[model samples]
Target: MYTYVLFVHLVAAVMGLGAAFGFPIVAKSAKTVSQAKFVLNLLHKLEVLPKAGSILLLISGIVMGLLETWLFKEVWFIGSIVIYLAVQFIVAGMLPKNMKKQLAALEGVQGEELPEAYLVLGRQSAKLEGISHLAAFVLILLMVFKPF
Candidate 1:
């Protein structure tokens, strides 16, 4: 039923967005080169949760829209969908690329201090992550308030 679908959607959002919101904090905890490398590798592995959650989110959201039918015509619903897709693009396409660059930049570094190249890439990744977080916040607002 609708309630069950809504439940699944909410769970997916939590699983996906919760991991996303935690990423910056996790990444920021690295103080040494080894820590940074370990964190990045761990983050890469942790990406699977959000990826799976995102897929479930999209599927459940579409099913709910189909069930309701009227939601398709709502401004808030449309806006949420748009924002969701944008976040997806950033998460799926941009973030991984940036992470890979960060990892590569860490290669051949010979000190405890983080290199400038890795720092630069980390900053870029953080900015992208910030944008995605903002988009996600807006998406949540739209969903919760339905402020059309």
Candidate 2:
């Protein structure tokens, strides 16, 4: 049972975290406003994969911890949970709002050239997304090493 739950957790992490790492690459490759909008729209549509993975991770993690009964006592486990929740808050709260800002900045703009406002918002969103990815990497390290 533990192994099964752990497997599910690992798969979820790979699915969600892997998708996250791709965002910057896609966002950075946009050469025009239409391209940027298409990328963002595609990202929005594909968000469900990560979101589903996140939900599975939470459920399986809690079950494993409950079965082992070390959720509160283990430092590494506690840290992972905190980091996971923080990442969730950023993903659910910050990222969407940032996306909206980017979209709003691009609104009514047309041409092969991009506007400064859109570029600025894109940079900001990229930074936030980068941080989230970094945090996710940290969480993965913690889970794998259990250094605490």
Candidate 3:
């Protein structure tokens, strides 16, 4: 039960991160509006992952740590989930809002070149990417170490 739950948790983390990865690819391509199709596809892929993988991962992980064993006594496992959730919250809040801003700008421009504001948003997105990637690494450590 422990190992199985761990496996599900890890897999969910992967899915969530992978979904977020679409933003960099999409945002980078946003500079070239003509090539936004690939980015759009990536965004579509990302949109589907969390709804599916997140639930499974959360359920299995909670079962293992909260109920199956006293794993919560371990700081690493607990910390990892906390960090993961925080990262998810930032991603959910930051990225989509940025995208929506860009989308609104697009509506104004009617699909013309991206504005200066959009570029600034893209730059900020790079920062978000770095933070989320680091969070993912910490989660990996928590899973492996399960440290108290």
Q: Candidates' lDDT values, in order? A: 0.92, 0.85, 0.68
List ranges where model 3 is wrong by over 4 Å: 37-45, 110-112
Best by lDDT: 1
Candidate 1: count of backbone clashes, pairs at least 3 residues apart or interchain: 0
Query: Could you estimate the TM-score for every candidate?
Result: 0.97, 0.94, 0.80
Please report the TM-score between candidate 2 and the true structure: 0.94
Clashing pairs in 1: none
Of the pair 2 and 3, which is ahead by TM-score?
2
Tens digits of lDDT, candidate 3, 45-121: 66678656666776887888766567777777678678867987766678667666655544545564666766676
Q: In terms of TM-score, which candidate is strongest?
A: 1
Candidate 2 clash pair list: none
Q: Which regions in candidate 2 have their CA more than 4 angstroms from the true location?
A: none
- Per residue, candidate 2 scores C-alpha lDDT tens digits across 31-73 of 8888988888888887887898899999999999988996668
Give the candidates in order of lDDT, highest first. 1, 2, 3
Q: For candidate 2, which ten residues in a row score worst on lDDT?
A: 103-112
